[model samples]
Target: MSQPSSRPELTPRFCFNQTALRDFLRLSRSTIDDSITQNLNALLTPSTTAFNPTSTSTRSVTPPSSSRAIPAQTCTSFKHNVLFPSWASRSDVLDYCAGVATSPDPDDPDSVLRQIEDEKVRERVVDERLDPYSGRYFPREARTESLAMLMRNERMVEKVVRARTGSVVGERCGEGGGLEGEFDEWRRAQGSGRR
Candidate 1:
């Protein structure tokens, strides 16, 4: 087709024009980067699923029954988990013990952990506040945050029992001390699962 020869033929031809090629390459790079990041995160994340897999929605699932109050060592302690152990920030420690989360820096909450100079102090924060691990019954509990709250409450109750010389379901010292240490004794009880 030889119509008007006004156009020059020196221009390089490409399936995608320069602007289109730039956009396409950028999109491709972003997609590849996202896929790689997701794969890496998958490797780090735990592979466990919820106990109730058949449920259509999370809201529909029933919650587990409340656990018996556990010992302070088996739960969170304000001195170890919340503040500096050496009574450095006494006021902040007081508030933290009363369930108030006080960040080291008013502007940035993350500075709370960053401000700790001692390795032991930082380790406590990491082991308790940052990642308060569940112990024996961790397998049954799926939600970490929920487990953390339960631990906190259990500790609080245990503290009260210690301070006031009270009794709790787990620490039933008021009922002539706790469970009798006889093998198959719990099985004899009507309510116990072993029965």
Candidate 2:
């Protein structure tokens, strides 16, 4: 056998798909229905009105689908509780931010500090959970992501911001309005923390 090189060649890896998993575990529609019935009896109730066994008048309750057709407000609440725990409620967040915005001077050091804390809270909420199943925010904080993918996404965000603002450096382009001073203060505060 030839001597192995200092750096071994990387080989691609394969993961089993869901269909393969189901086949391996012998999962079928009947099994899935049974599991669902066991798991969601409170949510899915069958009509229990008694009739003659010979009569076909027995009614059944249909289970809600995974689509979760609940209202947007309900979904937002679920996201707040399950996906975001940093800021309490959306209204509270908005009020706090508005209070900071309407301050005598947004560029004030104290107000900048408060805004930085608020942004840090928001960042924690977003980064803590990433749901792969629904391709939405996942509540499991321990789950990790690839560094390369994270870098790519960060670069993409920088590109989008540049495209929107039309400036990678220099003073605000007039459209940013008076908020520019507040933004600069916030960025300075963030940068100072690292040093």
Local distance difference test scores for all models? 0.29, 0.31
What's the TM-score of each model vs. the native?
Answer: 0.16, 0.16
Q: Pick by lDDT: which candidate is best?
A: 2
Q: Where in model 1 is the C-alpha error above 4 Å?
A: 1-12, 42-46, 49-195
Candidate 1 TM-score, C-alpha based: 0.16
User: For model 1, how does the per-residue alpha-carbon lDDT over 1-195 read when each residue is reduced to its tens digit?
Assistant: 011111112112211133432343234323322232232222232435756666656464443322222334422232122211111222122223323222122443334444443333435423345455621121222222333353355445433433332123223211333322211242244236444
Off by over 4 Å in 2: 1-145, 166-184, 190-195
Question: What's the C-alpha lDDT at position 143 in model 1?
Answer: 29
Q: Extract clashing residue pairs from model 1.
A: none
57-169, model 2: which lDDT tens digit per residue? Answer: 76645554322233345433332232122111211322333333333442233455556665665575343246444333323211112222333443354334323322211
Error of 1 at 115 (Å): 67
User: Could you tell me the TM-score of candidate 2?
Assistant: 0.16
